[model samples]
Target: MNKKTIGRVVKYLKPYIPLIIISLMAAAATTLLSLYVPILAGKAIDLIIAPGIVDLDGISKILIRMIMVILLAALFQWIMNVINNHITYRVVKDIRKKAFDHIQSLPLSYLDTKQYGDFVSRIIADIDQFSDGLLMGFSQFFTGLVMIIGTLCFMFTLNITITLVVVLLTPLSLFVAAFIAKKTYNLFVKQSEKRALLTGMVEEMVGNEKVVQAFSYEDDAIERFDKINDELADVSLKATFFSSLINPSTRFINNLVYAAVGIVGAVFVLKGRITVGQLTCFLSYANQYTKPFNEISGVVTELQNALACAGRVFELIDEEPETPDKENAVVLKDVKGSVMLKDVNFSYVPDKKLIQNLNLLVKPGMRVAIVGPTGCGKSTVINLLMRFYDVNSGSIQVEGNDVRDITRKSLRDNYGMVLQETWLKAASIKENIAYGREATDEEIIAAAKATHAHSFIKRLPNGYDTVLGEDGGSLSQGQKQLLCITRVMLSVPPMLILDEATSSIDTRTELRVQRAFAKLMAGRTSFIVAHRLSTIMEADMILVMKDGNIIEQGNHESLMKLGGFYSDLFNSQYKNV
Candidate 1:
């Protein structure tokens, strides 16, 4: 077991200390009543010492007392179980909530490098596994400890010499349990890791199944899945095999203790040192004492697995969150749309430089279009503008105020964005369009009509109330993009970012949407990223980027006359058209 991880888990129980105390009291009551039953049975046996001399009335009184004690023990046992269930589930709920909240605060840079399904596995599956083990530990561990101690006290009162014999053999059972538990912990850790890997793979393949089938990669996907599945199976089997050894191994040692006590007590009875009734009571105590050893060994096995799962959960909670905003950061308000980048440098990795010494300036209400080949840092500039990433060494200013000085929320609220990839939740169309802002039915319908999406939306069975599945299920790519455009149109912020926003729509719809976009961008400062040269013909200024540097900048007419890189790029697309 990991002492550090176990200690952390115990801290979650502090809020429920009173409940824990009550449960312990119940466990004690149950153990005391159970111990007394054996003594009553022994006394009843003494009353029937000989056939002719049997005291029927005395035996009957002992039986009645035993029945009452048994009923009380059952009641307390039930109370302990109910309380344990409550405590175990509450602790699991708290840990899960903390993990999820921490994931939200993490930086995008961290999220970009990890698999979504692995996080899902940790929060859902791994935490559930930990809950199961924790529940078992609570239900059995404390009761078993009290029973072991209580049985030993009663046994010593009847026969001290036999009780010593049982105590002497305890170390062997402890040693066996400890060794197996130590071996099983690491195996369980490996099993959890493999399970997460499998989950990630499954999620990826299912989400992109069309791409796999289109490329005839089904066999390769299956091979990769089988490899991970085999690993999980192997580790799980080993973990189970080792943990399973604890109960029987401890029981074997316990049986030896029971047999030794029986033999020793019988010898004492023959020598007149103890009566047969006392011998019977001592033998019962011997059996009771050893039973907890078996039960405790089982608890040790489960706790090892629980601690392993808990270690994974704690790792997520302990991750460093994104750097917080300044304590007294100013909120941006009523902004002109001017933006400036001065001597900015940034890279996703430290060793490789992507953008360096870059500079640009855009005035309010200017339509500046960025054009380049695929890896020319077109979208990266948008990322920097939005503060999704910070510049390594220089400054970005909005309306002459340093962007770092402004709160992120207010800064983001000033701009509207629509990407090539459209994302919609599993919700009604009206709800999807009205996301991030409160809008009435008239506003939502107007925005949809403006984007030329109202006709198709009205054709659906439920019209505006149709509930789509995850990511706008069964909706054509063109339809999905239109909804995203409607979302931005509804807000109409002071600044706009449109990156390949009309790529998925047909040429005719693209023409109509571009006109809608023109009206929307009439007075707002807009940054357009495009691969098709014709879409950006009328930009106020065209920036031709190559290798993260601006190779050319001018109006389209001037760039075409200069016959530079931009001219050749435009002519190539023109010929293709």
Candidate 2:
């Protein structure tokens, strides 16, 4: 485990300092009281049992004191546990929240490249293990140290010679513990990494179960899962086996110390150097001292595991987030939706250029259509316009203002978008349409009717109130597309982006959707990314893109008159349909 990672974990406790202090004090008091009770018991024997004659009054008083001390010890122990739980879980909550917020702030590109299940494991399983281990390790570690030191002080007062023997033998247990811990630390780290990998595998396979069954790849999928599962089991077993040896090894050394104390105490008693009562007290303190060593050894293993988990959590927290907006950045107002790209260049990777020297000037309220084959940088233009990614060279401007100079939120707020891949939350159809904004029921119904969705929605058991499953599972592809289109219609932004927005709807439904879009786009700038030639035949301007550059531009008549790539593309699709 890295020291920096452990330090980061400890920093989370700063907010709960008062609770931590109380817990520590309670732990100390609990250990001290429990240690003192054994001494009280020994004195009772000297006063009431081991004496030449017993005194009933003295015996009764001593018994009462012992019971009171026991009760206090129990009370303190309960307090320590309760406070430890509160502090640990509170820290866990903060860490999880921080991780989640960081995820929200990360760049879309970052989320695109990482595995989804790894994030799930870190937020849920890893954090849970870290908190549980820290709760046990911290409480036991502090109390164990206090008990060991307090017991040693009492032991020295009774028999200096015998105490020296215990001190000499104590290092054996510590040495054994340190050796075992050193050997198991790397194994625990490896085990944690493997567990995360295994979790990601399970998530990916389960999420794609339909695809697997359709292709009859069940045997292959099972083989891959079994391979990872077996590796996880093997690493876990090794780590557990090594950690399990720590307690017994320490226990063995502590037992030897216990035996030597007995021998030395007998020598002292026979030589008349100490009373039998003092011998009994020293022996009890000796047990208390050695027991902490054993307990602390167990805590060492847990602490190491906790640190391993903490390291993973800290790694996620340390990731650099998307660059912040410039200080006092410009906020667009009353956007006219004029967009331009001047000598722009971009690529998902640096070595492979996808878009170079791309230029366009679009007027407000113009219906523009961008058409291209696969991998021709069609959607890449939309990504740059939205600032989901920035152009590597040159500039993209909205209303003649460079997009880079504007706050992302303010720039994106002017445009409403519906993509080929539609998304809906697990909520009622009405709530999903409204999303976070307020909408009148009449307005929602009007939007649905415009997209030819009102009839199907009303036929459902609860109309707009029916709750959706994940990704709106109850709806067909066309129905889901209609809902998404309805969302964009309700927003009614100054600009629109429809990427295959009506491709899933039936021909009859597509006509209604296109009519609704025509009404919505009457006075607003609209960019339509479409494959069907019929959808964009009425566009005010058509950009025929190939290899990231616009090779031809004009309306349908002028482009077909050129008899170029656009003409071929239009004729091919027109014939195919």
**Top candidate, metric TM-score:** 1
Using lDDT as the measure, which candidate wins?
1
Writing each residue's lDDT as its tens digit, candidate 2 over 437-530 gives 6899999999999888999999988999999998887799899999999998888899999888998899999988899999999989989999
lDDT of 2 at 561: 99
- TM-scores for all predictions: 0.96, 0.95
Model 1 clash pairs are none
In candidate 1, position 525 carries an lDDT of: 93
Instruction: Give the poorly placed runs of model 1, Cα more than 4 Å off.
Output: none
State candidate 2's TM-score: 0.95
Which stretches of candidate 2 lie above 4 Å from their native place?
A: 47-53
